[model samples]
Target: MDAYSGYNQIFMHPEDQAHTSFITDRGLYCYKVMPFGLKNAGATYQRLVNHLFAPLIGNTMEVYVDDMLVKSRTADQHIPNLSAMFTILKQYKMRLNPTKCAFGVASGKFLGFMISQRGIEANPEKIQAILDMTIPKTVKDIQSLTGRVAALTRFISKATDRCAPFFKALKGTKRNITWTAECETAFSELKEYMGRAPLLSTPEHGDILVVYLSVSASAVSSVLIRSKDNAEHPVHYVSKALQDAEVRYPDIEKLAFSLVVSARRLRPYFQAHTIHVLTNQPLRQVLQKPETSGRLVKWAIELGEFDIHYKPRPVMRGQAVADFLSEFTESQASAATQHITEPNPPLSQDQTPTKNTLDLTQPLWTLFVDGSSNAQGCGAGLVLVSPDKVALEYALRFNFQASNNEAEYEALLAGLRLAKEMDARQIQIFRDSQLVVHQVNQDFTAKDASMTAYLQHTRHLLATFHAHTIKQVPRSENSHADALARLASALEQGMGRHIHIEFLAQPSTQAPLICTIDHSPTWMDPILQFLQNQTLPANPAEARRVRHRSARYLIINGSLYKRGFSLPYLRCLTPEEGHYVLREIHEGICDPASKRLAPRQPRLLPCRRKTHFRGARHLLKLSAAKPNLQDTCRHHNGLHKVPHWNFVQSSHFHFPINKEQYLGKTKNHSPTFTVTLPELLLVTDLGIGERSAGTTPVSEA
Candidate 1:
């Protein structure tokens, strides 16, 4: 129900009414009651409603500013829920607009969404808006279309992918777009999808939600699903178009990115319920492994807040879920249990069968690998052929430099990793590098340190499979892998191809950087715990105080931010970080005038209390003062007597350092200055280390 004249319901103080006054044609007018368009007007109304409906806000009612919703699980509870809400309104003398309020309805529009007994659904008006749109002819028209699509993105699966064409058209300066067939096809497909927008399911307490991730060449998408009664219903669909460096991420990293994006967008659902991510990818292992890529480690930490479980995805049980399942094809090697095919060509009858020869009795997947290193770049390519002849082609470009032998090992390792990911139990590996193959087969010794490391890593991976064979093949026989390696090494990005190309930022043999996270207690700790977990002090009074104070603070992305009346939300920092900021500001670069005035005006250093300049790395920027410090500097005994430090050190001011004893006043008493003006004031004497003094004026002294 909507409040009748919501802003006017709250009265303003008589003394403060003049501040809101406006002059009219005849006389000055002032608002006695809170008026619309005033800052914090909505907040005031919300606070009043919250006070009245504190007990029912989350249970039977929901409120956003003046808009209120009284929800009931069953028809029998509907009247009671409405009565509870009305009783509070009556007691507070709050009136509702009959024209804007509805009661005893099964479903109604709330906040631009159609809420019903079935579930929350896209607004009919929004769907109609997209359905009614004509082909976009201009840039503005395309933007309008994309904006509408974004509004109902949750209802559309792979929304970013579907709208990628329009985004591409918007690039560069163009008043009119070509409106190619691709855009028209995407436009029609979008309208068709919107015509039958899926009904989103709202998960209840204790209901486990499942997330399915989909990664593509240009975009990553995931759908949050709720399983009930042996069927799956979509809770939300999330998708993002990769940009800049993101486009170069490996397929596995893209999968992780999809999950991260989903978690960020659907944090409320994640916090409320346990999420089970369904995928065939080794996401859990990658995330749980201590030694992994830096970004994966960061994504894992971000998702650590939720109770998430990783499980192999099962067969598609519902149409909506099946749609997401069909969004991407999983690259898998043929099963190892297949019947043995024709045996490989036997060597001369007199020659003994070597360990590298494939056994005819057992089914083995064939792997052909090659590497290329040139002036252009370094890359590796591998083809994993299943027993049934299904080939999985993969190419990898190394972001870092590598030699020819190193790239060959990279190719072999890449093939092994692909086989592992495909669950291939037994495999036969063929490479064009005779040295690498002979080393792996123990026919050649790896004398070089890098070669030894690569051989050890290759054997470690080979141990995971049930059985494996390695042999060297001539370059002519391994042409497929050779061509792929060359393609990956020289081809510029954005050139579309069927072969999946991924960029590896570092060599496989290099160990991942180990980083330690500091979790020491900070001022935000208590507030964050209270806000996130509802934990409070044991003392009753302190608990109450914490609850009240938590209203002005909020936690976002594991960081605490404070709310304000007029200022933007500010991030709260620990004391150590705050000190660093203050020190930087105190010693940052300053104008020449500040430097010249600094030594002359020592009084500026002490305002109400003494300011210590200990461990200063930069020259102090002193504000100009009327009093000259030249008198404070005097020559005595062929040395410049600097009295400023003595005066500061002797002053009985409450500061960080101790004060010197004060002598009784004498008419002729002059300050004793034994140290020279600059020469005697060494950096070590002031406790500023030699390293810090190098950047300060004390270094000259």
Candidate 2:
């Protein structure tokens, strides 16, 4: 019975080893001592014990290695249960450790948790370890100690904000490490609170409600428990210090994090009961629908795992005491259970406008649009702007067969094209289709070839305007467009035609086309005009082909492509134009190569001499002196007389070779000198004649 070493086998007594034939016998007569450190020791022990007492103990008694707990409700049944377990131990020759046994106790501690007949509580020894800690001298020391105690703080109340001031004082350049009155108070209060922590009732037998609250830098959470008898109690409180990055999140995001963390921390309790989350913020508004922002949407998705309803502040305070009770309350424990559950009110129409309104004062014009398709035809809708905000436009382009996304894309394209026609210098387009907006913005890649082509065309259309921007607005904010899209779909379905058109004019003398719908040859002009003005392809054949294809889409499925414009509609050009367009596309796709080829090359040339120099006065003097000496020697030794040596004069004159000699070199050889065979034969033949005894006649040739 060591705690770390589990029980699976019994050691033979030294006196009994001689009588045991476990070593020699290989049959059933021998009882082998099981190995203690085997991988299956724990499992084997549990299996063996369970099998041995299956008839007597059944499910009443459970043993895990050396630790055992026997659960029974009444004392009358304990003696028999104890006796049955003792008989098994004796039969197996297993000895029990006297000091490690506990019997007939109403509550017992095991597996790092305390369990009782009525409830569960934190181990006092674990809490005492936190209380005995000395004051920290450094930030690291304080954080380490606090982190260890924070694990047990879930059993205390107001753990986050209550301890914030103490944690804050640990920062700064002051090294004196003085504990302020607030820090000392918080520290001592935490220990005292844990010492008197209440036992939490089992969630299986109670109705649980969790209240989660969050600030910019911290999140606080608490759980309330109430039995069917209406006796309510505070089970435990938990909190966590948010990272610096988390503290900078928007108010909605912070509130979302608070609820998400609380739900996860209390999953065991909340999972067993229908839990209600009461918060000071309007979390219901966020949870009522999906979010477009990935971070918020992901957090919202995490919140969906628990069966909990979000109660807003205004509604929560009246129906539930979340705020006051969350802090410090001495009211009767039953007060929390007195409030009646109120059903959520039906949504009012007046709230719809407030929910969808955008901030129009911002520099960019925000345009919202949506599209839908049904059995009748595909329809697209767009709402450019309203007095206070941008209204979602609902345009129904009938006689088009496409998917929901295709319709959405057509609607978006129409809105963008209309914005461009309005001379909107700066545009901020909003839509609930995250896929469409993200794809167009190049934030995500197009997974399909058709989508890739359509996205490319859509981006080209967007680039025609100055300062064009696209963003994903929440579905709630894009309601106007959603409504228009639904209406268009309804119109198409009711009409049962290939083409349908409608226009909502602005409230002015001009009555400009705020919206348009058409399905006829006559409507083609306006559609063509819209495309042309938007710099969309304008070839009639191409347009007719596009219109026909788009019409076919409507006829087949009553669905238009997402962002509405078809690939052919955006690309109305002949084969030649298409070739050029393809070339341009290729160039754009290969821009990296073009960038590398743009720099100029450095200049290089062969080296050459600029000028040639003539003979100097010093060279002329040396030539004159050498000739004078040669003439004096010739006059004395009777050699040839020296001619006039005009060395200085000759140096100033330029010489030219004779024309015959200069041009003497013909195609093969120069005529300056010729060698005869007789001259060479004389030298070679003289040696041969001198060595011969007989005289030989030399032949002349």
Candidate 3:
């Protein structure tokens, strides 16, 4: 009869019990009944069958519950052994679940584990149940669904923890019964993962496969299946929410749980195969060394069963992808396209009407240019438009080692050169780099030498035009020129000049830069104040070193380092160093009026020497009376409590006295005191005193 083991209990219905009793009363031999749902029912059943089949166990067959396996070196022996088991079951009036039972079938599943003539196989149907499950709408639904598949939870690494957010939302106290965006995202991802859960291959035919198991604080186990083909697949994915106590385990310990589960579950697969295990940790390294700690030694011994190969997370991704693909079938190919949807329809003409009517009222040409540079190379390009609404494109590539600023300057130069060639005087230059435009307009000075040279060249070129204006345009608005720049750079292979030429009608002026130079004292005061407040270091050694560095940077400023010492130079120093140098510079360079206003002393903390003692004994002792000494005194109290008087009295004492005291005997001393002190004579004892004494001594004859 079909029986499912439930916890430690064996249970049988009244009908089955009556059938078994009737058969026994009829004098027919029957195997003892261990009902399903009884505590230890499976174990008790197996033990009973083990005894009944003991004589035939190794000879030809073995039975576990309703399932029987007949194994022999020869097929001849296997057939008869199988028949004998069936005959015994018939005599016991017990029936096997035909659907659940298998005989002489090369492969079958029994007791939640797959069995084959070759070896045991991991059940993939269990993983399919998780994958095929619908998105759990409510927490109760999710729990109820997950509960039904709890036996298979071990196969799902880190089962509960990965689903914790979903679980938390289900609690009676939790609000927002609807799943959150995060919960939905996690839910969808889990469903996708379940859908892609792989079928673990049988570990027979000597083919090797490795199982990588990992765990996190929130999750219990993550199992990655890898075949010797070096292709990783998911044998079964399992994870559980860590219990309160498990969460306290250190990261490595928590992670080791996956390995523990995988090792136990996949034990049958590993016994006959040599598999290289992959783990998302250095468990292998920890295991290789002799375990120094009891816990580590225990973990190591558990992991020692398999050959392990540790892989970092980055390296594990490739294997994980392979495992991901193992679940794919021909039918699921169409599902991959769900991520990419059809394109939007074209907009109606009225939605975006053309505004290309030419404006001949003011005849002017506008040029938009852009530039870019990286360590590899630099490029510049420009799109010129005529008053007739036509666009002219030009781009150039420079092979020199230049910064983005220089590339921009060159792009401006190229546009200016193009405008001059086109003989378009009173032209407007539009550029994405604000720095380049400002520097060209003389509103900002060119900071770099290369840019300065380009700026000079640009000014000289601009001089050719009767009237010219440069305006900064945002990068987004300068895409036409940007594309040309990238194209120009891509066309040129090496360090050489390359150019592109195209044509277009320019659009009307979008924005304009109005240049107004006023000789107002408002602007000069800040500049003058900044220069007057500059300072240099007082230490000649430090000053000289800074001066040498400044000399290299100051050549462009056109003055010696000492004369040109300014705030800009000090800006390069770190905050603390910059403050100190600025203070020194202000003290030395500032006018007397400014000098008086500066802080008299530099605002910096004084340096203090720290004393460190090597051992605890070298620390200072503290009295109980001092508040500052409380910690030390409190500890000392334990060490220096009052000694027990009884113990002190039991201990022996040693004391020393001077010889003169014993020898000084008074004339008034009584006979009692003399007798107590021992007899003292004028003649000295040789051993006790000097050799002049004629008295016998203890050491002398």
Candidate 4:
């Protein structure tokens, strides 16, 4: 039952009520009862519930903050359970909303889910919200869809993997989304799945709960199960989209990640019962190793509290586990190659590569391309197999948001580019995206301007090969590439399973210049000379001095920089630049229009220092366009509020802070975050429009 004005039900301490008063035309007034804005209102209400329901909790009743439920084994006992709860409510002067509360109900919705003797199930309304919805066109629409999906993720299998395509749509700065074929297929499938969504079972005391872990290219999934009468039923499904460095984790790590996530989400289950992790991987050995990677040790420690045991998976016992097995099965040819549905028998022994060998001849290269863009993020996965049957897996993560179609084209483009780099003359491309294949073959007209551009670029790239053929196959046939795409699009979120995966900062549509007009030295030459050549000035004394100063020196974006004792990477400026900076620091007094400095008396030290310390950027703030800061601030706020983070934009920087901490910082650091601060800390702008020379990272001495 729902509480009546739950937070406001209790009276505040007489003296404290005055603190909550608001100003008005009338004399000051305060809340006699606890108000909604009280810092400890929720916690205080929870304490009251715990106190009142102490005996009934976990036996006949379950109370979560203001929401309470009474359960009984028999119909006759139901009345007594209700009476006992009501008796306590009366003693505490507690009230329930008559319209919100129900009596003698067989089943009902609570805490955004439906609970009953049949076990827990996702709310029908939540499922219908996605099903009844039209295709999402705006960023907000896609965001809304993702939000609904997140609420029901526990009921959905491989939830992160399945919804990957939507995340791709929200990537990058493109405001208008490209709703592609993959999204349409996924949308239909999601609705169909929701139409008959599985009923989640609850584990009974002493039940030996088993967890089946499944790790895909871009997601880690686990299903918590309990057996009854020799039949297995799912208690909960957990999924997480891996990002950044997490994507590079080994297979065992991914498995561990899945288990860790499951344990975290179902902490109560772990605390109460023993959990058997069913997997072929050596999870325990890795976690229990004397020495291991930092994250593994961290994950191991995180999972240390759980009563978890690892064991090899037995044969699939139920349809649900069977489904998990099917989605995550890898091919023999490439351990990294994941097929959504199991493929037919191997083509031949020649088609499989042996260790320590690759023959790049035969003039034929096979390409499988699949693109997934979902709420976790958008990415394209491609498996390029050379003539010798050696698979070269490339997962291209778009630096920006892309639609499914755009992602498909990206995968195809990336695959062709890789093959071209390998100097492959002939190619046979296989993709699950029918629209992209048909468009490339001129069978389907490129109706949209974006697709037309993509199709044109694809054709242009395909033309580089001596012979190339494109075919649209069933999704199952292209599962390997599809998995690769999902992995690529949602990279840095999880560890990579098989072969090494590479990320592309941008799409082929916005191709960068492959060749530059000239390659020459600039400000970086001195540092590069000192580091690489170990050469200093001709004079021995000056040379020794130059070598000494090079320790903290770094060349960033064609300019020299020094690692400041306190600051990070301070720009090393030339005399001319320093003069211009000093002038800009005196922006108000020094007129840029006049060639000579004004013959005016200088101000006192403190006043002059104040203006000087404000820096040139702050002084000239009115002249510079800082739409980036406003857009960035808005994006930052939107990111915190998003239920599911869309990794559509490939290179959104992730700081050490988590989402919760970020929100806290946002609130405390800047209540009015809309106003852009001065760009005092500028990224390198050497006046050179583009990079024209080879680059290397700065090494701190």
Candidate 5:
């Protein structure tokens, strides 16, 4: 049942009526009833229906803005349900459009979709509109085509991949589009698919749902499926086009990303039912223990709210599901070098190989690696040759110093990473470094700590593949990789050259030291929990307060940031971290003066001064404690005065601050150390790191 003039049903308040005043031909007029096209008109009507049908919505009826759906399990309950709905409408003085309303119907259109007992389906008009569209020749036509596809994305599996050619055509020139033959082929397939679009299934209560994930070069897709009577039906289809850095994510990370995207888009389904992610990749382990990358940590936190489980996808059951799963499985298999699928017989005299089990007869990829380290610089290079004889060459320059053996390990590790990204199952490695190859092959022991770390890391990556072999080859035979390594290592500090060189900031063996505030309860704990998982305190008042405060805050990549009036967003920090930042700013700003005063000590103590915190970026002016009256400090005991020093956040250094009182309180009379206010008082709940260059920490002294 559809409400007649839904917005007009609600009368505007006497005071609000004046705000809707408009000039007419005769005189000014104001609307007594709520008017359409108002920014909050739709939302206002939705709230009214929600309040009116609070007991029936989601149980016996469903409503969105003006559209109302009255549902019953059988014909016997239909009249009673309609009676209950009509009683509420009578009490609220709401009228229904007789022409638009349909009663006692098995299936009908609701919210631009065909809804019935069978399942929700795309409207026939929408499918006809796509079928009626002609071949797009201009940019606008292609845009219209993409816009139509966007409306039916939930019904289309891997929608982004299918429409990638159309998106590519829209790029570059706006007036004229580059309509390639790929577009024509994709357009025809799309119409063919639309003609027989699968009917989506509505999951019943307590029914477990399954999600099949697919990752392509530029997009990630997943289909949510519901199984009943040994047959699978698609609940929804989701696909996202990767942008910028997302396009370069490792294949495993991309698989995890597909789940995250599904969880976000299908949040309602995830919240209501249990989700089992069907995949062969180690997505569960990667997300469960996300210490390797920051993005993984964030994705894991966001997905923690839902009950998601990982399982190896079983054999396809239904044709609708087979259509989606077949494509997903085929894409992954075809990406591997010489990958083939063969069914194994049941166990008897000869047992058949299980799924995903490696066949030794398959061709293995070849990897050639070399490293160069000299007075100029250190660098590594590798060439990965596929079974099909396609070769991929990569050069990596180390930002930090590395020994020749370490560089060789880096080269081997880089090659393994490339192979993994290409979905290679078996690999054979040949390296010019005899020590590295022998150590990896277990012929020699890695006695050095750094070498042991590198060896362990290499073994960890090697474990991902089905099988791998490492051997030492003469430098003469590995000339390609050796020359690439030299080319990258010998390049000048500042030169214009582009060969897709990658800079390794640090070795993979070393884990970065990051200060995480999520472990303990802080000012951001309540807000972070609410924003991430919708978790709130048991107390009603506390929950309300958290909800109100969360409006000004949002979590981005696992960090809490507060929206500010002056600034767009500011990262929140703990008081302990704030004190560390202030001290670092003092050291960086007054490094030269502190070294001049106490050349032997080089300690720039934080003096008494007012501090201000605001905006995403801030400049801090710190006063360095100087005993002498000169512009620069020369002594540590006579008389002290504040000096002007300014600095921005650039680097981080570790130093300890004396917490003793600084105002006229002296124990040993060694220039009374002032502790001033507490750590929390120095910076509010919102704070950031500050630093400057060239400073010797007092801890070192």
Candidate 6:
């Protein structure tokens, strides 16, 4: 059943109708019935339908405002359901359009999806949109394809992974597309998939649903399935591309990430049913492990409200789940168990536990922090001991200069951060520095501006803990942390000679703010004005220079940079320097990768060979004489200072310089060639009449 002119059927209040009065050509009048464009018309009409059909709703009929469904379990009940719906419409003085109304039908279209006893099917027209599409040539075409795919993502399994190639193509330069072989394969696969897209099953009430997860390097995918009569059907398919740092996550972490993505996307389904996460990995153990860090810990806490269970994925039950079954280095076998449950939810930030209301007498974490700033360098070290005695040792070496007291503050801050990641409810910190401990405990005032900023940040993090304390310990008492700090300080000076050391670019209390400068009337402005608009500065010399300069540099997204195949976009160099750069790349003397290859070569070593290691090393450049330079290097590290070397490596046609040229050896018998910058340039300009003249072998005098 359908209500004809549904919004018009709802009458406006007699008194309030005056506000809606509008001037027409004939006369000024107000709407007695609710108008279609009025903001409240649809809601008012829906309210009327809901009130009139309250008894029939969800029983023999389903009403969504104007469009009404009079459903029945049997043929006999259909007539009664229609009669009940018609009576309400008549009493409410609402008319039904005969053309739009359909009665006693088993199936029909409600939303965009088709509805029937069999299941919900994708709209045929939507699927046809994809099938009819030719190969995408531009960004817009790929975008259109993705849009069409998104509308029916529930039916298309691993949708993100399937269309990842299209996304990659789209991410390239917008003006000119480089559609590779990968795109063709993916596009064909997409059309084929959509042609035979699966019918998404609607889950029945009280039926337990299963979710199978799949994690690839590029994307995380999951399929929600409902079991009926021993047959599993897919309810929804979820797939998301892993962006930025997510791509670098460990295999198990990626699995957890997939579950988190699925949970957030399918929150409504998760809230409605007991979802069993089917996975062969120890996902439950990883997420629930006591040693789990803050990232996974937060994920587990988010899923706390739902009755989500983890179980070993069973044999592929349906064709929909075939994609979920992975064959890889990761072991799929789990101990034979139907359900491996998680422990009860931990106390999240949302759960506010007061000391009085809730007994906050649990043992707090112990932190030992120390900082060193002697002649060696500046560094901080900390050891975080959980209530259970698991100790986490951390050291930070600072790149920027910091004082002894500042280093002490850094040590304290690092300890707090590590402790927070461990989800420590309470903590007791011991620091060797009296000034740091005193400042944190408010026993000493922070006079310096930097120290004050650090103090505020420290207080903010400390507030996150239920209860935390800090006390000053003697240098001897905090020996372990002190030693760790000394080690970090020594490592900063490159004296440790062991282990992977991380340098802290900035202090712990401060996060670097990246602000992009939109400089007006930049160096590129006059150049761009000349090129695009043919407008330039009034002066003839300046205008001519602008026109000349525009040729060497191209303005891309409002930044002036020197562009060349041989050089990096040089933004750091001045215009004069950039001019010299262009000359070098075009004129046989540009070592693009070497920053020291400036016009003057400020920090470069002298061309004269150092006699300290006689004939041990040689820098080779392509000579005008050698068409096929079959040079070899076993120890390339010892070689340096030759121009046009980057060009030789990049261009395949540039003199056939063998791998040995770059990776040459001091220990090998392979002949080496040493040529000065001026000599190399002369060699490039003129072909070698003889080897003795243009090219000089290192083995010879």
- Which ten residues in a row are the worst by lDDT in model 1? 629-638
Ranking by TM-score: 5, 1, 4, 6, 2, 3
The TM-score of candidate 5 is: 0.52
Q: Write down the TM-score of every candidate.
A: 0.51, 0.42, 0.35, 0.48, 0.52, 0.46
Which digits, one per residue and each the tens of the lDDT, describe model 1 over residues 280-396? Answer: 767776664433466875676677667677788888777677556643534311221131122223234333324544466666899999999999999998888998999888899
Mind giving the per-residue lDDT tens digits that candidate 6 earns over 1-701?
57788887667889989988999999999999888787877787788788888998868777887888877778998887778877887787888889887776777877678877788899999999999999888878888989999898878888888988888898888877778899999989888888888988888668798988887768888999999888889999998888999977766777788899988999989877878988777786666454455677667667655657777867786787878777221432231122233432344543432222222456568899998898768988888887778887788889878999888888888888778767677778888787877777667899999999888777777767776677777888898888888888877353645544567898876777999866444456676665345476888567556644554554443555554444455553444454354334323344232222322332122233444222123222322333222121222233444334433344545434566654453224323444222244422222112133545332222
Q: Write the per-residue lDDT of candidate 4 for residues 1-701, one digit (tens) a residue.
A: 99989888888898898788988898787898888876788899899899889999999999998899998888999999999998998998998988888888889888989998999989988888888999888989988988998999888988887789999878845688878899989888888888889989988888889988887778888888999888998998888998997777766677777787888889999878867887665566566443346676567656655556667788887766765774254632144333111111222322321211223443478888888898777888888898889998777676688887887787788788788777676788888787887777766899898897897777767656556677779988988888777776666646756756666677776757787556344444555686445555677565555544554554553466655545455775543454454444333333232112211211211123244324323423532454533332233232222223212222555332366665565566566543433311223322212342443232222
User: What are the clashing pairs of model 5?
Assistant: 597-633, 649-691, 662-674, 662-675
**Winning model by TM-score:** 5
Write the number of the candidate with greater TM-score, choosing between 2 and 4: 4
The true-structure Cα RMSD of candidate 4 reads 27.6
Clashes of 5: 4
CA lDDT of each prediction against the hidden true structure: 0.75, 0.53, 0.52, 0.70, 0.75, 0.70
Candidate 4 lDDT at 485 equals 76
Clashes of each: 0, 36, 45, 37, 4, 8
**Candidate 5 residues 416-503, lDDT tens each?**
9999878687788888788997787777999999999998878877777766788778889999999889988988777887677788
- Model 3, span 634-677: residue lDDT tens: 33333322333211122352111444433443223443544543
- Candidate 4 ranges with C-alpha deviation above 4 Å: 326-701
